[model samples]
Target: MKYGVLEAATAAAIIATSVSLLYTPPEPSWETEVVANDTYGKFVEVDSYGSNVGIAYVDSIDTGLRLAEKSYSTSITDFSAQRKGNWDTQVIDNRSETGMYPSLESKSGQPSISYQDGDLGNEKLYYANRQNGEWNRTEVDNVVGGGTSVGMYSSLNFHQSKPVIFYHSPSQGLKMAEKKQEWSKEILEDGQGWYTETSKCGNTIKVAYTGRNSEQLKIGEYDGGWSSENTSTKIKSDLDIDTDQRCDEQLAYLDTETEQITYKDQDSRTFGDAFFTRLALTSKGNTTHLVYHDEGTGLKYAKKKDGEWTTKTIKQGSETGEYNDIEIDHIGNIHTAYTSQKKVYHTVYNKGTTQKIQSKTDEVKIGLGLISALLLIFTAIRQEVIAKIIQKIGEIQR
Candidate 1:
């Protein structure tokens, strides 16, 4: 009977210790603020330049290309009247039917964007770059003959410190535009492309897209020259492609008619339901992060680290994350710009906030551990096992 009592006491002590160790408080909430609003955000693309973040999107109501620049500061009081953080917004191009599929990036600390000039009769590709604190817009490509449409799904990146853009022409399939002293255009592949995403790692540049006519997913890689490889993966909507420092390419896309966000690196994994999905990678730990929108929930983020995948909800709303973009800075800070209810928002995942919260949680856990141990010792005395502990102590002394 005494042994049974001692056994019960031991089980209670183990359970108490387990509960204290397993307890985890949630992380700090995301710092989010409006960047632009009022039916102006569509096809948003975000990129990080040093400690600053830049966003380019289409203004649906005004039909223009808009840009928002915000420098990240840890203190919320850094800016006047800041909710999270305020952005300096401007209209880079207000031409009619322009800014569809704006892709933003930075090279040599200057932000630039490549987008489509969507005027039906003068359909063309446009490039805009910030020079001397001013935005200079230039016409990149316009193969306007026999009803050819160019620059619908544009993707921009830098190669060897030069700006390169991958886009699709309805009559010419897949194309690339590179500016070397002057802007030049070339055909990468032959197929009506739906979505085009480009990334450059080391000496290799890769472009991933889908065929509009066949609905097939394909990737084209360029080391010295262009080469094509086909994938059996068929996406239900647009997709994002990125490469880590190790040059491991990843693809994140809306799969099965937007029922889920599917990520493919070496293998594929699906994370619930999502609408517009965007992907970014951090070289710090080779972490692949994705920002996406659920149908009824809100904006969500998922990341894979150390072979395990974890997700967190950024914000809650039925219409949040409808159109979104994700970018990671040099220090591993995640910046996301998304549109919810037609208003564009910028959210940051502050690592310092998470670390402080974790430190407090660790202190709480240590206190709980001590308390649990004391309670178990008291239970041992009540169960008459105090004598046994005393005897063990005495034996150890001998």
Candidate 2:
């Protein structure tokens, strides 16, 4: 009777501890830790090479675009005279509007950019490359709008040692250009392409664009003819590429090979407004990293690994993630740049960080672990007693 009571008590104690621990709230896995700042962003973009991270942004006062180039190894050594921090600043155009739609990438470990020459009547697309310590600006294409300004969005990528660009013009809908000493142009679509983005994902060209209405989100490829990879049309989504593909904008990734589009964060609600809600993507191998802000959810990051998507909140303070951009290094580390409270800040993914979670599955796992341990202990103790009792019974029978 005493042994039975003791075993029951042991089991109960284990169960109670397991329950309590399981119920304990998970520690917050993230905090809004800023790495650098003072660079303003109306349109902020972040990208990385190996471990080096760079940012490009444009503010109202920027006659030219701004570049913030820093590495995880070095401190802010040289501060930009324009920006308060130590960023390698470049006077991209100095002409008014040249810096309006700034986008960035790394080439051979140096920064390259594509921006609209937003100088009034010359709303053309320009590519800026740095070679031998000088920025050589090339006019990729001239959008004919006669000064009304149409190249509002421009994205850049490199494929096969050549530059690929995507931009929008009122006359040209969504246009893509490739540079090989000279530029070749093609129009992906006819309507206005709002917030269009293009990138090189392992030789595959992925273009993500919002429509003129700012509601529709569409992804496609820029091959011989532009092929629709995926589309998201919400109740009010502005762009319509497909009648079947449906969802709100939170996170969307394009798998170039399979032409599969994975959309995530549909449960998000706009607490107020996801103003400047932009998404940026960078890929490493089969995994793609996406960063964007949901109206109510603040800044969020996600990566598709082994065909599953897992997301984590970088900031929960509402209305953040605006103009958010993300990059992953060759080593698979993640870096992000975003705007909040009128300031531009940067953050990186820390695997050591504990993520706060309240999950039923977690509780079940804890409970199961305790039960398994208890069962092992009980079986070991009973094995000897059971053998002795069986032997005594045999003796009596004899």
Q: Number of the top candidate by lDDT?
A: 1
Error of 2 at 60 (Å): 4.1
Stretches of candidate 2 above 4 Å error? Answer: 1-40, 73-87, 143-147, 213-218, 228-276, 282-288, 303-311, 316-318, 350-398
lDDT of 2 by residue, 54-86 (tens): 777764455556666665431122111112345
Task: Please state the error at residue 387 of candidate 2 in Å.
Answer: 35
Cα deviation of 389 in candidate 1 (Å)? 38
lDDT, candidate 1, 104-217, per-residue tens? 889888889998887776788889998988889999988563135788788888777878888888888888888889987888777745778877889788888898776678
Q: How high a TM-score does candidate 1 get?
A: 0.77
Candidate 1 lDDT score relative to the true structure: 0.76
What is each predicted model's overall lDDT from 0 to 1?
0.76, 0.60
Q: Backbone clash tally for model 2?
A: 9
